[model samples]
Target chain A: MSGTFIGMPAFSPPTLPAFSPPTLPAFPTAAKEAVRNPTLRRNLRYATHTIRAKRAAAVSELDDWAALREAGRQIKDHTLRHLDRYLLQLEESVTAAGGVVHWAADADEANRIVTGLVKATGESEVVKVKSMATQEIGLNEALAAEGIHAYETDLAELIVQLGRDRPSHILVPAIHRNRGEIRDIFTHEMSEWGRPAPEGLSDTPAELAEAARLHLREKFLRAKVGISGANFMVAETGTLAVFESEGNGRMCLTLPETLISVVGIEKLVPTWRDLEVFLQTLPRSSTAERMNPYTSMWTGTTDDDGPRTFHLVLLDNGRTDTLADRVGRQALRCIRCSACLNVCPVYERAGGHAYGSVYPGPIGAILSPQLRGTASDIDASLPYASSLCGACYEVCPVAIDIPEVLVHLRERVVEGGPAVRQGAKVTLRPARGHAAERAAMRAARWTFRHPGALRAGQRLASGTRRLVPRTLPGPGRAWSATRDLPKLPPEPFREWWRRTHRPGGQAPADRQEDQR
Target chain B: MSSRDVILGRVRRALADVPDDDTPYEVAVQRGYRRAHGERSIGETVDLLAENLADYRALVHRTDAARLPGLLARLLAGRGARSVLVPPGLPADWLAGELPTRVADDAELTPHQLDRVDSVITGCAVAIAETGTIVLDAGPDQGRRRITLVPDHHICVVRVPGQVVSSVPEALGRLDPARPLTWISGPSATSDIELDRVEGVHGPRTLEVVLTSED
Candidate 1:
């Protein structure tokens, strides 16, 4: 930790990797650790099933849900196509409403700009609303490097911060954690942060919630600076809306004097009317609520009402890169609802931490590869994480075809191509790890084209069927590790068909019964 | 180049493939979603608001003009509140001859001081029935945003038929976006813990909305 004195030298940054660290173990390896933890598996299963059923019910209530989904998709697509214009318009609107706008090209730039803004405020500590953008950029760790502490005010965020853990889900970051674990975190860690957990804190959720409110209340009341991310920003009005269940968002947004919003450039709606579609879809999809408990909206700063000074930081770490791809741009349309994650069989089995970015699950599988690129093992492995299940696509509020994008990115990975990186187009070599898979695919393609060769190969394999084992060896062992390989038949299908039926032959009785 | 120009240049380049005749916003979106779930009369809308409000655990009270003051007084008395927060332009008779000491909302009352107070009473800007939302725009009756936020108990008076709208779109039409608006469906709540919905976190622990027949 930094020295306690004001003028004293700050210590070197922690040896620990920052939140949502830059690289993670490959998906299969990371997911292995998650699948082994029965507690995490049970927690995710229970939480995901509960929200999934509720979301289906909430969405079913709206007869216009399909139309709303299409509209949400189109509206986001339109805004992105014309983002340069809308962004300038948004800057103008926000400035007109008495706010300043700053632009950051990448994560480090965003961190630099925010750290400078906080230093300028002459404040060393800032209160934070739960923001995925901030988490994505490692802002908290960056601030800590400069001797500033950012207090996470959201209940789930508070649980995460105190536990010194990474968030696993978008809407519910602590979904993998249970009540008992939370009680332990609060009991042990609350005193170091601010107020200690209440005496005899139990595992009851309400009691734990009260303890969090008390612990964070002091920070919220005294916070001179507030940092946040928004759900939607209106270009027409320069209004930013934050949707939250707990009043922690309300406290952080209002109680502070200087407010800094670090938003992705894409969270833009042209007007308040455009907000109606997202307002209806996001809450139901994310939290299964008709309306979240509180939605606090401010146009710049209000007079003595909320923060007096507002700074809007528009971040584009790799968004431009993602947007440049035609097939992959739909990933940008996500509202971060996590419906895709909940419905994903892969996510349920593997959990959120495996995707290794702030974004995880189907959306993450496609998004992380594009946002961070596929050069890394985890990013390259993300596209292959799914079973090509269409469940995630079926539930996305913005109708992002996650499976389609996953396939597109897989193609990009296996075949060398041009992709945008850090705002410039670069030609990428085919990822090193996928070479074996690529050769196997190419060999299969060759065989499919040669029917006579395929028949001969199949007949030879069929002749020696008993020699083959139930499981494969070498690189193929990964496949048969969890599954039994199909046993080859004694005769190839072509020969069986030739023998069973013809102009002068009849269908075999045993084959007919099997077919029936 | 400034990051602004760099980002904008990249965005323009990203969309180089878009045709000159992209779908206009008006034609592009089909917002055929029913404006309101089902058509209901004014009274029915207010009833739906109360039902949904109660559904989310917000206490719903109904009274006409004459009994409104008594109902509010009883609520305050029931909670055993000593210090009550009063917004600037709340109708005088709504809580006339009330028992609690009126701590008027002003600049001097800090959040901590407000937290010390037992309850806050205000009038809402608009109420949406379909979602069971009460919007406080910090208008004359709602005072500053913190007055409603800091106190543990919130009693908002909604003059039914006049203040109630059937849907969110209808409510948005009535609200001015310039104001510091808080849309509250229930007391501050969280489903963060194992996805179990628990009411009362940082905002008022108990929210009591009174739907008065007399506007």
Candidate 2:
């Protein structure tokens, strides 16, 4: 692996853009809103279950899938450990291949770099392939601010852009909206963007697809610049790869005079050899295909073949901070297959919109906070969005332990310490919400550590079990109201164990591991 | 900052933090990962592919070359397809028999015209038996990428034993890595949120594989 090269711009502090999208409700509120939409829930339930079954069947066919998953995990972990070396190698190789490599520290910096690149092209409008990295940095918004327009070429993405909607799923950005809603979005909004919907555009799949195809066809042929994200970056060869079901990506990549790819640094694999694992895992895990229909790979620019000028923006945006933590770094292993999202029960119910990022689902629960930080109310609320059912873990092609990371992030949030800023190592001040929980936990921790105090406290609690309120007071009341607090036994387990076993008699088998 | 610069900076910093030694890459083990996690071998990998293909509702056939052309013609005839779209560079012998078909050149046809074609036939670049994937580059025989997309039925020919690979690393060695590669395991399909499986949302609806073994 190589390290970062290209004289890329650094991220300045994030400036809250004037035109922020509808503020994502705090997790509970958004989730509640999502649950009430019966049509959306039905769509989610149907889609997730069917994909889950196919994925299980597909995975069951591979006796070595477990091994493949482990290999993917290990390779990613190893790469992340020495990410700098690989990034440099990547930069040198890409540059040597006639591709310019740019470095972006955060979303703002990344957007600025991309906007500047477009401005330099002297093109006010660019065609875009569905890229998560670009969305993360709010590049489209930034470009618009600089008087540049980005036309989305992907069908679902076109629907999203036309409707002025935020993507709710990684693979299917418009997964939250149904066919009827899509028909309305296209018919009412398509003309404003470019071509209008055909006369009598119905809610049928064919009509909707036709409307989008016509809408995007114009953008693909006329655009002078293309923007994209890669599925994988081969470090040794400096090749960038994109896998898609539609042929739209191929057009955007090949048609434009100048092509810009803004990729997350974690997208790299050491060699083209590493691509095999992801190519297989990505299609199968995401769309439940043995392989994707279109897997487009380009190395810099080719002579009279594709784009003449190729630029790669390798983005960090809190990735380095994410990589520093041993346990949390497992997130980089994600191939963005969306298998975890398909199998995620919470995602099926609450929908992707509730997660409040372009990523959505289980992967988003852990990834967004680490990358964006748990500073804002929405970011802090993401970790608690899961039921920890581990469906996401079971389906992950790259085997990201999403629940583990969610719990880890939750612990960080509840620690009530100062926030961890981008590129900085120090912890900032306690977030207001977690202060009470942190104090309570600290007192409980001190009590648990002292055995004498623990046993006495347990007895007191058991005797007063009836007096305990069914619902907790203050912030906790909402939680206990919906859930049944475990009833206290007649006696604490410690007392029961002591009475059953003689003191110093091997300390009882159940407690042996704890003692060790 | 451009999106490129934002991403590149982070990648630069990430690369800067890791040590320069090649030990990490060198010690990156693939075998132990499989051993500790995967218990199967290459033969089992082949079996997985066959089984998974069948599970996806795709028709899988094992045939010798002498029997392949006849078998494929029969399969097409059964589907009531009058003419099949043949890639310009497809092996002549694959369709040597007397079957009436209109060959579609990937280079000349538009998306609207290709959609009207009944079936498409081409040789695969590589077949990952472990994942049951069929890759096609616009190599000499594969033709343009759109032919595979517009048609509802795709009959991909795979020369078994020769083209098969047990792992992704093995497949990567055979590919150009920079070419426009199309990987197919089965027909293109998607599910609604209600868990209803719908095939042919974008690509071909039915996929048929004729595994030819001349050895």
Best by lDDT: 1
Over B1-215, each residue of candidate 1 has an lDDT whose tens digit, in order, gives 89999999999888887776556667866777777888798889999999989988999999889999999999999999998999889889887756699999887767778779999999999999988999999998898888888889999999988999998888888888888889999999999999989999999999999999875
Q: Second chain TM-score per prediction?
A: 0.95, 0.81
Per-candidate TM-score against the hidden true structure: 0.96, 0.78
**How well is each residue in A161-186 modelled by candidate 2, as lDDT tens digits?**
76777777888877777888888888
Question: Model 1: which docking level applies?
Answer: high
| Tens digits of per-residue lDDT for model 2, B1-215 | 64444344444554454566556565674633331125567557657667766656567888888888888788888788877888777888888765657766744454456657888888888877655677787665767665666566888887877777765566778888556666665665433222234444456667888778757
Which candidate comes out best when scored by TM-score? 1
Clashing pairs in 1: none
RMSD of each: 2.6, 8.3
| Model 2 ranges with Cα > 4 A deviation | A1-23, A198-207, A416-420, A446-467, A488-516, B1-27, B32-134, B140-170, B178-180, B184-215
